[model samples]
Structure formats: structure tokens, C-alpha cells
Target chain A: MKIRGYDKENEEIKLAMTPMIDIVFQLLVFFIMTYKVTTMEGDYNIRMPSAAAEPTLTEETLEDFLEVRLQADPETRFLQTIEVNYGADRQVWNRSAFPVRPAPGEDLTAAQLQQNRDSRKVFASLNQFVINIVGSGSSDPGSGSEIEAEIDADPALRYEDTVYSIEAISGYKDDQKRIVKLIEKIKFRDTTNQSP
Target chain B: MRFRRKRNEILEGDLTPMIDMTFQLIAFFMLVINFSEVELSEEINLPMSELARPPEEAPPFKITLNLKEDGSIKYYDQLIAGIDVIKPILVREIRQANSDGVATSDVVVIIRADMDARTGDVQRLMNKCKAEQLENFSLRVIERLR
Candidate 1:
């Protein structure tokens, strides 16, 4: 309880962390267990389309969400492509079974002819298949991150047909829908990137 | 007798205790310090959106949604086609978190979006949240706290 060299017998002494080693050991274990090794890879540039909508949910209601993909040509206003990004290496994309608008009187498969008769309907059916393909193993319907979307057709593709096409693929009136709550998210890839 | 007493006094105040304290302090800092965080790609220029909010602070169970300049989505740091598939994963992750009793509602979703991201794409992401009823998300921004 005193310094060895000091001649003052009244000198006050203290135990400097005589038991602090235990604290160090405990911290070592804590940090080790708290260590997280996330393997998130890739650096995809996702330019989020902004919105002025009011916020919902809070810091207390963590839930699921969907990542929607729209591949459209602004110049043509066509609903070129659609899909949803679930995770890395997984997707539910729309496949157009239309007969590529082939020249008149060309032989086509029954499935192809059926697809052309109802392009929008066919597109919708394909998308439905894509949606059902997911959560199949799950017993719950809400067990999915189902999204609703609105197609803001490009000026060229903004035709009633295009909108019809989009509506066919995604059932909803662009306002009332659940899950992905998708709508026409315009900002497409570089328009200037187009080959003139 | 005085000489013997002086010899006993010399044994007091050994440095072993102070050394132990120093080691403990070092261990504490090393444990709390997040050196792995430095590995995040600096090329990621996360844009700050007015629609963005702060992330949650808890046991660190969070989802990261990386945005591209062209309004595409990058999840788990990889390129995903769209939200159709992303939904199931989010549901599964949240359901799992909820089952573990680890406060799934406070799940900190870090939206790492690009500066040139489109307003529409941003809306789509938020819409995805509405579908699942999940909240407590934050838009990840690059800070100069270093």
C-alpha cells in the first residue's frame, strides 16, 4: 500500500488495475463476437429515382422490399423490358413471346401465335408466372416482396398500347397496389449512349 | 529492524498493475474499433437525397441497397434485375430476424444511392417498402468523420 523507495511511511498507495486484466479479457471476447464479416460484392451504380411522397414506417418496423428493373427506350416510348432484382444472381424478368412482328404469312409456333394475339395479355401472363415462380415453397402470400409499377412510357412508346402493355404485365392502377408498389420510374440508361 | 522494513517497502507499487490496466484499455479500443468498415469501396459516391433519413442504431442487422448512376439497383453489392426477386429475400431476412427476437422492425436499411439516380427509381424503392410494411430505413451517405 506504499511506494518502496519513498521514506515517507505516511505515503498513500493504490492498486493500479490489479483486477483490470479481467476487463481486457472480457472486451477481447466481446469485440470478437461482435465482429461481422459481410461479403457484399460488386459496385453497381443505382441512381435512385427521387419522389416527394410522404414517409411511412419508422425506425421500429423493419420489413421486406422489392428491387424493380425497367428497361425502356425513352426515344421510342416502348415498354422494352421489365424485371425485379431479388438478390445477387437472381431475377424475375419478363419475356416477350411476341412474333417479333415478322413479315406477313410467316410460319410460327402455336405458342408464338398465341403470344402475339395478346401481347399485353401474354406479357402479363409471363410476369405472373415469374411472380408465382417465387414464394412457391412458402405457405404465405405476403412471404414475397411483391411490387406494383407504372410505366411512364417514353414519348414514342407512350402510346395507349404501351401503357396497356405495362398494365397487362403489372396489375394495378399505378396508384393502388401492394408489395413493390412500382410505377413508371423514368430515369433510363444514358439516352446519349444510344447508337445514332 | 528499520533496514528490514525498508526492504519490504521496495516491493510496493509494482508496474504489473498499471501494465494490466493499459492492456485492458487497448483491448477495449481494438474491440470497438471497426477497421473492416474501411474496406467499403470509396468509389461509391453515395448521394444524399432530401427523401433520405438516418439509419437505425442497434445490434447492426441492416440491409444495404446500392444505387447506380443510371437508377439500377445493387443488392448485397451485386446487380439485381428488379424488385420482383428482391422482395422474397427481404421478407425471408425480416422473418428470420423477427424469429430470432432481434428487433426486425428496427432493421437499418442502408440505401447507398448514386448522385445522378433518377427520381422515379427512388420512388420504386420506397414503394417496395410500402408493400412489405417494413420501416426504419436510412439512406447511406459518405461521411468525413475520419
Candidate 2:
């Protein structure tokens, strides 16, 4: 009887609570460290633009993303003015239209100038280019060839066309940078349209 | 026949250890259950896209828009409701979210609208979102693979 009782005592089951507590604390710490706490405060009436994407930023913050703002078109529903902007590094981009055309009777070198001029006139409506601001004169056609329009792109300009435009420009190849020191607006974005 | 005696005849099966594990499993399932089926029965179909990817994480807030095939807007799974009801709910949600520590830019409002959804409907929603001061968002579409 004494031997049987000893065996029964050995059989009584027990679970160490220490390991369970350790695991719980480990999970709690993991959740806290990986947690991204942010606040969402905005108008609920705005149905946000949805894509299959989670709007990502590779090397920048939401504040640093390029903006192409779209307000309700001030004119007809058919037309919308897009204001484009990139932040600090080149906040003030300048625009200029240099009409380099194929020289009438020239060989390769002169023809290249014509090709270059014919290709596109650079223009900017940004705040950073000192050259466009400092180089104006009577001899230099009063700045319309490359107009320097003011740019105040809204932070909310994260729409398709606007985002596409910014990505096209900001992500543009630097090989073209030397030739594109001046920025040019291909067409004037009409800002005078009446509110929709 | 002569009676046969076997020492193995007194065998017993233990139930406590198995019972303890079963209870742990049941507790786990209870804690892991997601009970919200609020948007599944909308009768509205979300558009499927080839480029769709899985969501980042569950947002503390969201706005579900059900788009009718002919470009009509539905509110809260109800068809063609007033825009007035839509505005305050959105504003209040944003306000409530602010108190909950989610910034306007951090909140993601997922639009589960149909693909044939009108450009105007999409643009109007963007405008409303801007008015609400909510900045960050993404569209929800069905995964082609699914």
C-alpha cells in the first residue's frame, strides 16, 4: 500500500507556469516593438482613391512624396488643372523654352542644336532655380519662352495624373538634366476656371 | 476451458493530460475568432484586379462604398441614400479616430466599389476625403489569384 501511494504521488501531473508566462511576455514585447501607432483624422465624406496597392513610400515619408494637386476643376468638368511639386531639394524649379531647331544649311553639329531645340523647351514654375530668377533682361526675351510660374502644389495632390506627372519628372533620367537646366511648361495650366 | 490470468488486464488510460491540451486549443480558437461579418453580405461585388495585393494590416478605421453597376452610389449597403447622411458619419469617424490616435493621413478608407464605377464617383469621393482632411488611402480590389 505504501509503495502504491508513492507511485500515485509521482503520477500527479503538473505544468510549469513559468514558461507560459515567458511566452506571453515575449509576444507582448514583439507586438509593442513592431507596432506602428498613428492617428487618422480626416473628413469621412471623401471617398479615398483605392488601388490594389497600400500606397507605399520606399525612401521617404508621406510629407516628402511628390505632390500633384487636383482641386475641383475651376472650369468645365472636362478640364482639370494639375499643380505639380517636389519638396526642398529642388523646391524652386525654373522653366525656359529654348527653340533649338535643325539649322537650315548646317551639318551635324548645327543640326544637333536644331534637333535639341526642336525636341523640347525646358520650363519651370518652381521656387528653387536662381538662374531663371537672376538671368532676366531686355536682351533675354522677358522669360515667356520658359515661363516661371509660381508653384504651391497642395499636399493632397496624390491623384493619378498628378502622381504620374511628378514621377515622370522627378524620376526622370539625369542624363537629360544638363540639357534641362531650365524648366518649361508644355502648356499653361488654366487656373482661372470657375469652381465646379 | 481453464481460466487464464494476464497482468495486462488491469491497464488504464489517462484523460487529464489530453483534456488539458484540448482546453488550451479551445481557448486559442476562442481568442483568435473574428466575429465581424458586417460587409460580407452587401450583395455588392468588389472588382477584381490583376495588380491587387494583400492589405498591409487591419486599419482601425475604414469606409466601405458599394457601387451599383450603373454608377449609382449606395450608402452602408443601402442603395442611393442621401449624401447628407454620408458627410457627418465621415466627419465624425475622422474625429473619433483622432481621439483614438490615428492621424488623418494614417487612416485608410477602402472603397470596395465595382470596376465600372464612374470616374466622377471616384473623383467626388477624393474631394470629400480631402474635405474631411483625411489624406492617406488605397483602393480595395479582389485578388485575381483568389
Q: Best DockQ goes to which candidate?
A: 2
Per-residue alpha-carbon lDDT of candidate 2 for residues B1-146, written as tens digits (9 for 90 to 100): 23355553654556557556655655565455444435432454554333333554667776655544444556555565533245776787788888989887777666555544433444455556656766555554554332
Across B1-146, the per-residue lDDT of candidate 1 in tens digits comes to 67987777647557677666667666666766676464244445563222112323243466666656555566654676764457876787788778777675456555565544543454456557545655544445432121
- In CAPRI terms, model 2 is classed as incorrect
DockQ of 2: 0.07
Model 1: per-residue lDDT, tens digit, A1-196?
A: 8778768666776666545657666766666676665432222112222232434535332122233445545543334555554333244444353333456788777776776665455455434644553434234443332332333323233222332343333322223333321222212222222222
Tally clashes: model 1: 45
Compare the candidates by TM-score and give the number of the best one.
Answer: 2
Error of 1 at A75 (Å): 13
Backbone collision count in every prediction? Answer: 45, 42
Error of 1 at B75 (Å): 2.7
Candidate 2 interface RMSD to the true structure:
12.5
In model 2, the runs with Cα more than 4 Å from the true position are A1-196, B1-34, B70-85
Error of 1 at A128 (Å): 49
lDDT of model 2, residue B119: 37
Q: Residue by residue across A1-196, what tens digits does model 2's lDDT show?
A: 4565676776847575556656655655554454442222111122232332235545545333333333323222211343445444334222222223345795557666664454232212321232333234113322322322222232223222222232223212234332122223221122222132
